[model samples]
Target: MRIERSNWEQRTLGEFFDLQMGKTPSRKDLSLWEDGDTPWVSISDMKESRYISDTKEHLPYQTIAECRIPIIPVGTVIMSFKLTIGKTCIVSKPLTTNEAIMAFYPKKGIEVNSSFLAYALSALKWKGNRAVKGVTINKKTISEKNFSLPPIGLQDNIAAELDAIQEVIDGYKDQIADLDALAQSIFLETFGDPISNPKGWKTELISKFGRIVTGNTPSRAISDYYNSQDIEWIKTDNIVKDLLTPTTAYEYLSFEGAKKGRIVKSGSILICCIAGSLQSIGRCCLTDRSLAFNQQINAIECDVNHIPLFVYCLIKASQQLLIDTASTGMKHILSKSDLSSICLPVPPLELQQQFANKIASIEQQKDLLRQQLADAEMLMAERMQYYFS
Candidate 1:
């Protein structure tokens, strides 16, 4: 269905929807929170894509009543207005958000399409730093700032097309996730229990096969040390996703900064060693060039006899074991000693090469699916812009 851009009309966001900011109830009021049924959402619960229906925390009706936080209905547009600015999602169920989120309810006859709003918000060139306030920044306040929206009917049509493409993207995502699980299952079945490495192949501690180099962070006070592009710097947040190749989602650092922190050479495996990212313990990527990582990460230079990809797969397969062994507290951390003690199965070079080749084939297929998903999404976005200019 072709949509003519001229058919669409425009209006400010505030004109189309009633924007509601959220409030945080007093933490000291424990009585208000007991056995809460209301789903309470925070920025942490907001994913980059797709509506979030579940949250890690919940609140009681009493808390909701006392706080007077608005319960946004399903299909309402929710956006992160603070730390993670501009990211948006629709509510799939009745939920209340923290001060970090802004909820938008379509005004009568305006009929804002939730998915359209989400994609539009994602594409918005939001000036997040401008929204910062004293002490703690708030997204709710930021979302109140004005933006434009397309005509109601056009928005609906575009959203419908986008939603269809989104389903395809979702299918690809599901397939990738399933394939990853299948690979993990294969690893477990082939190696037996993660702890034992039961094939009884030569087992050796990580320290025996690689050189561990700890990372450091340059002073944040020196602003000149950072650059928009210079050297890729890996952080804990970048470890959550799979990367067949090294890529950083954020800004690179200057050569000086690279020198300040230990230079992580290309092909060296980067591992997260901090608390907040304990689950990212064994996450590894081969850097394209020498880069700097913060103190929370460590660079492991593999020996010539071992393939970097194979070691990464082995470590990834053992990630759960590492997490289970992590120290208990509000935060979980993997110490240098703990990392050094991790044992891995040493398969013959020929076998390792074959396994690497097989995994690469699977990864290539996954990557193609991912690219198709991306292209589909991009086409949808472009079509929306054309349909609702």
Candidate 2:
């Protein structure tokens, strides 16, 4: 499927497509959003899916006219060019998108393959300004971005080849999702609902399970504290809800820095206790090694009576409670006292062990699926580079 691109026309996106950016109606006006059936696309809606069939939110036709946002036609390619750049998809139906997304229509008398355009746009290495949310690419820069356009027949062939690869990737992702779901189901079947306590298991404050330690960042003013990468430093970003093990940190601290921050021992549970986004506040993961962490997380070193994985899963199941308990303000924060006071069902030690065993098996299966997913993604990345880079 790899073809020489030397003879293909080197062209800017604007030359072949008319660019249109989307707009959001004032969020304060419930009239614009309620009782509406028209799909309103946002960056979140474009995640994972190549063809957008439905969106998370919808607006009324009246709002479309009132907001003066263009109704992108079916099969038109759209790319998110602002924060979280380079996500691209084809709209399966007429829809309106938020300001971050740009719709691309074939210019007058110009024919372009929508699938090829989406793939090409997704492959773009965007350079954008960094802000609080992330990176943002301006419209002018996006219009000037370049790509080589092959003949219509060749574009179709290339799209087909990439689509086949994507199908394989998606299949692996579905299997991984299935294993995660299986774990959740097993947990519920074994322990009953944690919230309702259908099995009448004894409940206690989270503090009863372990020594709770809120993490702290080593002083940045001390040059020696951060000059060398001597130990892994866990941040809120390093914790992932899907994985029991914390990911490698993007940063590290010196041995002197480790003294300033609290060292969470291996096999402890770490939870994000502070974040700008409320959904991020309750994210939890387990520590596989001793490391220093930032103040946004709280670590729990479980007592002899508790299994660390069980406590981690228990907190995950109580995520809604954490969010509900957090103070609503510019930033959501779960204070140490607030986190410790939350009640969790404590089942018999033998039952906890059984649940742990089943989950471990599920985790092993997920690990293999993740390895396969990574390999498939690498192949996809290589193909994309060869075709579009």
What TM-scores do the predictions have?
0.75, 0.92
The CA lDDT at 311 in model 1 is 77
Clashes per candidate, residues 3 or more apart or on different chains: 4, 0
Top candidate on lDDT is 2
Model 1 Cα displacement at 314 (Å)? 1.7
Tens-digit per-residue lDDT, 45-78, candidate 2: 9888889978989989988998898998889999
Name model 1 segments beyond 4 Å from true: 1-11, 128-151, 196-202, 214-240, 248-267, 274-276, 287-297, 304-307, 320-338, 345-354, 384-389
Badly placed stretches (over 4 Å) of model 2 are: 1-3, 66-68, 126-139
TM-score of 2: 0.92
lDDT of 1 at 8: 49
